[model samples]
Target: MSNIVKAKIIEKIQGFYEAVDDNNNKFTVKLRGTLKKTNDKLNCVIGDIVQIDVEDNVIIGIEKRNNLLLRPLISNVDYVAFVCSIKDPDFDIINLYKNLLWVDRENINTILILNKIDLVDDKELEDILKLLSQKLKHIKVIAISIKKNIGIDKLKEYIENKNIVLSGVSGVGKSILVNKLLDIEELEVGEISKKTKKGKNTTINTRYLEKNKIKIYDTPGYSAVAIPDYTDKKEIMTWFPEFKNYLSLCKFRDCLHIKEPSCIIKFKVSEGEIDKDRYEFYKTLVENKGI
Candidate 1:
């Protein structure tokens, strides 16, 4: 008789998957030929729980995922740590907001990590924090410095025993932070380009690592984040939590908040109740049909 057991996919390379069972027994499994033939759009990815045939070392079935992210192509993510550096590559609020929109659409829990705080002075850091607080009050922000070993413990506490993915543009210190968290210098750290002041791509593949029972998926840094195609332009407003209260107060029942008469959202922007930059960014996303 053939035995089958449940396992979680930790990594995928070439055509094989590295999975670990409940007992921590590791197996290098391949997709069953029948499974491949049937499902044309196979969605198998890291963090997906699957059933494997022990005898054949083949993935037989994939369990239903709670959530999935397309960019890193991971399933069942509990938290996404969007890392941004204050210097080196420089902080780009627009990019951060764009990533947050993607995460909000997926209904995933997100934490904004401002890395490289050591490079910025106290007043500059305070002002940035203030700006973020006003614009992104719904999300939690943690400022960390890898060089000075600041806020690492606090960050670890927030993600303890949870499945997390470190995502950011290349050169934002995601790999370096991972090394610190895992207490090993395993992943390569890339340097920022002196001319462009942008991070060079370092992590090319997503890999899973465990530290004190904390599950982490370190993903490749993206220079440009791609929005999900499934995102409905009409529902873009729903992704912006700051617009929630004023949305219901709008004149039209289905107000897109653009050129609409007596729009509460627009009025709030004029009153300085909403961040103008954030509102403008929202308008851009909606006007472009979420492109």
Candidate 2:
């Protein structure tokens, strides 16, 4: 008799995943391909609760998810932190905006972390902070230097009660942050290549630390990607918290908050009410999404 087995995906390897059954008994396994065909939308990502056949050995079907991320392709994730570094890789504000948009479109709770604060001078820090505050108004931002062990307590506090995923580009200290979160010795920190100045991928799988009631899913960093078409942001403008109050005030009801007559958003951007960097971010998004 095939049992309807429900399991929470913990870690995924090349073609196998380590899942926990209802009783917290763990098993290593793979999904049946029929599941992929049936759930047209299912891809069996990390953090997903799936119903397996458990007949012989296979994940037969993945139930619908409460939350999912496309770029890293993680599912049922409760929180996403867009970790940024103030120096070294230098802050790529544009990519940061795109990451924020990904979370916002998915309706997932998100936060921002400005890592490597110890590397920047006060002026640089203020400039970065001011830009983020003015532009990404709806999101929360925390500053830290994980290598120096600064602000990590606050980062841990923010993610205390959730199944969280840390995602961003390489060499921005995602894995370093993971080490801090897990407090593991000889903590698998990979060095960035001196020649390329890029991160040596340390974590190849989604690993977790189960204490403190916090399960942190450290995902492989992803290259910067434009927002996925896999979602419907019909009112894309409104998806941005900072854009909401001024959305209605846009000249065209269909206003993308871009290039319109009597556009309040443009006015704010010009008046310095909106951060110019964020305005440019919207422009880039509209261009990339071809909205």
Candidate 3:
């Protein structure tokens, strides 16, 4: 007879998943593919809780997930930190906005981390923070310097005892931050290319670190984010958190908030209430709705 055991996936390698049971026993399991065969939306991913039908040590079934991330392909992540460097790779606001939209659409709780504060001067750092503050109102922004060991404690408060995922572009110091938080230097930190001035991808695979009752997932970094195509073009506007207050005030019931008559969002942009750069970015998104 087969017995069922509950386990949470910690790492996924090729066709195998590394999971730990409630009793802290590690198991290498294979998927039953039952959910996929039925065309169900559920699929196995790292950070997922699953039940396995095993006579010895093989997985035959998977449980449902509380949540999932498309880009990094992680499941049931409680918190996601979008880590970006201030100087080395430079903060790409456009890419950052796209990431924010992706998180918002997924309805995931996230925070933004502007890393490498030690590389910039006081004035420059202040300006960058001010710009981000205006664009990202109501969202927490933690400015941290991994090398200088600044703001690590405050950052830890958010991720403590939570299933957290660290995602950002290459060389943004995601691995370095993890090392600091975990208090170990096992994870390799990549160096920026001298010729291209871009960060080399250090982490090629998704890995998890469990320590001090903290579960952290470190994902490989990407140069560019390819947002999945939307079935409905109007869904784009809903991703912008800043537009929420002005949404009900729009004249049309299904307003795109661009070139529409009596558009409150546009009015706010013109009146300097909304950042012009952000509005332009939103316009760009509206123009390229499929992307």
Candidate 4:
């Protein structure tokens, strides 16, 4: 038996994978023809470090993933680029929360990108941004217009030297930002329906882009968010970094904070200690995520 050679799969399409061997040599190998991929886990995403068995220059094994995106089916993500738009598609706050949830759930840090900034004048967009600034703190928010190529450097710097996963609702400009980031002029763009102004979801699978040691995984855009599995509403509360401390003071151990007495979470919400929209949305997520 020969020693199993390892390869990092950078992209997969139509049963063939573009992988880089340990020596940084890239090859397009068929999954079944080159390696016996058992398809073990459902959570495997791009950017994953995989172990491959090779004999006589043929790959054989695709070990496992550190983490993966459920819908796009990629793994080993390092960071998440959560994009929202100021116009064209507009911002959906609820979807924002889900993107935040997805990143935090996987322990991936996030960088918030506000796209289509050129659509609105500074004065017109100021208020919405001020509101967002108040609600979301501690995370980096970069405003950019892919059309004008403005603010592309900030996005370029953010994902540079790292593996990033792009996530957002359809028509919010996820793909636009991706194209601008790579500057490849070859990435696919999604079309939005005129009636609903929502993206047509061009990306069917997770795809990878790499340059200068930076890797990006672009996920298929969705029109809305499907809440992840969370046991208690309070368990979901822990996801909010700003609310973590106040949670200890809640009177009841199982406080949903909707109508509970001596509820610290509610008090904070009332006192502006917590973002009210987040608290309300947390309740909303509970209803949806719960079976």
Top candidate when judged by TM-score against the true structure: 1
Q: Who is ahead in TM-score, 1 or 4?
A: 1
Superposed model 1: Cα runs more than 4 Å off: 32-42, 186-201, 230-232, 245-249, 271-273, 289-291
Global Cα lDDT for candidate 1:
0.83
lDDT of 4 by residue, 1-291 (tens): 645556777776665567776467776655444334376443222455555544433445556666665545566776777778888787776677776776666555677788888899988778877887778764677888887888888778767877787877767767656665666563333333442344243676777776665677777766666666665555776667667777778888787667779998888888996888887777776655441
Query: Candidate 3 clashing pairs?
Result: none
Query: lDDT tens string, model 1, 50-119?
Result: 9999998999999999998766778899999899999888999888887887778777888889999999
Arranged by lDDT, best first? 1, 3, 2, 4
Per-candidate TM equals: 0.85, 0.78, 0.84, 0.78
After the best TM-score superposition of candidate 3, give how far the Cα of residue 40 lies from its true spot, in angstroms: 7.3
Residue pairs with backbone atoms closer than 3 Å in model 4 (clashes): 45-74, 45-75, 46-74, 46-75, 53-60, 53-61
> Per-residue lDDT for 123 in model 4?
89
lDDT per model vs. reference: 0.83, 0.74, 0.78, 0.68
Model number with the top lDDT = 1
Candidate 4: where is the Cα deviation over 4 Å? Answer: 1-6, 11-18, 21-24, 27-40, 43-45, 56-71, 186-201, 231-234, 287-291
Error of 4 at 38 (Å): 8.6
